[model samples]
Target: MKRRTFDKLVSFVGLGLAALLLIFAGLLNFGANFANDSVASQLENQNISFPAEDAMPSETKDQLAKWAGMKVVTGEMARDYSDLYIWEHMKGSAIAVMGKPATYSEVSGVYMGLVRGGSTDVEKIKQYGDLRQTLFMGNTLRGMLLEAYAFGTLGVIAGYAAIASLVGGVLFLLLGIAGLMHIRRTPEDATI
Candidate 1:
């Protein structure tokens, strides 16, 4: 009701919201770092490489074609291959497979396709399928490394947000304290 009280309330609310944002940012950053560390540890435990020869076994290619059934491969199918075919075949230090080195951004784009729906182009599906297979299977360690990089990037963004939120929180808290300190009893002088 009083101007001083209203100012105090507003300031406190602002400070509280700022504090929450700061906390959220911290959690996000921590999560990102944790993800990165986990990936790093996994990568460090193994060696990864892309096969010089990018050849798909005829049987495997046939199976993929059968699965395709004249229609484009669905995201679900891609994931299935990643989980089943790729995961099963993945072994030893070699982790042999086909295809060139794919950038993280390219892999991310393919992943986005999986999240969205699927592609109709047979070649795109095959390329992405191979990409996912190699990334998830043969080069699992490298894949983890890529994932860690992504998480680290996210952490950097979160860190920036955390710093901003912390600054805002401190400012709001200081303003609230100042408002309370400067409050006057007289109605005319009560407004902060």
Candidate 2:
């Protein structure tokens, strides 16, 4: 091929690579957004309440104070009183307080567990119930899997890796068309 043809090929390759990158970026963004939305939906659907009250059981306070500096709180002891659990419980309670129509399928089970545990005080029961994990079950894993699935599904539907892929394809197609027209108009330019 002549110099002009070679240059055109190089330009096309560059465009294609840039498009691929943009598409991937879009996929990442969409995945993150979808995962967040899913989490919010699950929280709402499961009726997991939050914790925001002056009343905290001694056990809960001890546990929470221990893990207050950490972002993630798991394991047996922390399960009862971590901020994560409190946040979930508070949200659920807030919904009830607001008189919103929501109910946990496991409400009875939760109450029974508290009763069996001999924690009649609402604050104490809320603190140690370990119900958050149950309400938003497998939340972390679900978020990751959801993101991957959403990105993959979008990739197939759009014929690109991400939402940005569409833009990439459009720009690529336009450039290709323009280049082809330029070449046809100056076929002799290739020889020069």
Candidate 3:
């Protein structure tokens, strides 16, 4: 094979790869921006205003009790209660009652049952409703915070990927240009 032709081929391939990388980087950046915007919009729409204290309004507590009373999990639902219960029964109230979000770690702890207190008797259910309210609020706050953090992390990763890809693309392009220059300086008939 001719040395000039080989260099030309390498140059073209490198340039092509660079172009592809740049395009990929652009797409990744676009996706990251879109995701960030979406998350921000969703958060704004939810209007979460976490409270300073772990207290729920009396009306909210009553509503929680009513919802709890209405819940009749059966079979698989009962088995999946942990997964479904908080999200289904408490998410809206918890978000509203919380008035603001908590950190992901705090919420995850609640979700994982790490934040739970000692078991209470059935007779003490009414008396401990306030405690339940506080727990619910914390759980809700944690869930939202965790979701936001996840979205933010995804955006950050995408941004990093985009930056890496852009750098790679630029390096590849420079190498391709250098190869083309080398080809130009070599004799056309030079054999490899």
Candidate 4:
């Protein structure tokens, strides 16, 4: 094939590749931005705020204090609120009542066992009921926060991908331009 023609073909192919990569980068960037914004907005609407530094819970005092007085606005913040704040409080309450830090399933099973045994002590029934309710709410909140964390993580991954794609696009574009310049410098009668 003629050297010029071969170079032209390769240049066009490189340009096409650059265009495709750039388009992919743009789409990924949009997705990442959307995910980040959605997570922040949803958390903001909840109006959840971190503990005052001095009021940090005993077990998570140092970790929780990092975000003290800050409202939940990001997935990381949501995770901190759920795991450090809400989870600790729930566990503490359970320990106070049940004499142990137990999971929601554990509490539910015990409560159901008592009911099945036909226990009719009103105070005990109500105590279990209240504790179960609090745990249920805490678990639900934790699930939501974890979901936000997952989405935000995906967004972060997408952002990194977008950056890589952009770099690839730029590299391909430069290669394409260099190929075009090579074609210009090639002799018309050159064959390869």
Best by TM-score: 4
Q: Which residue pairs of candidate 4 clash?
A: none
Q: Which lDDT tens digits does candidate 1 get at residues 1-192?
A: 668778667767766776776677677667656655654454445432222222323335544444432221222333334433444354211133224445434665775676567556766566556656555544554344445455556655666766776777677767766766655543755544
Writing each residue's lDDT as its tens digit, candidate 3 over 152-172 gives 668778989999999999999
lDDT of 4: 0.91
List where candidate 3 sits over 4 angstroms from the true fold. 49-123
Q: Which residue runs of candidate 1 sit more than 4 Å off their true CA positions?
A: 47-144, 184-192
Off by over 4 Å in 2: 1-3, 57-192
Model 3 worst lDDT run, 10 consecutive residues = 72-81
What's the best-to-worst order under TM-score?
Answer: 4, 3, 1, 2
Task: State which candidate, 1 or 4, has the greater TM-score.
Answer: 4
What's the residue-level lDDT of 135 in candidate 4?
A: 98
Residue range with the least summed lDDT across 10 consecutive positions in model 4: 121-130
Give TM-scores for every candidate, taking all chains together and pairing residue i with residue i: 0.44, 0.34, 0.58, 0.93
For 87-120, candidate 2 gives per-residue lDDT tens digits of 4454555345334422344544555677797775
Specify the poorest-scoring 10-residue window by lDDT in model 1.
47-56
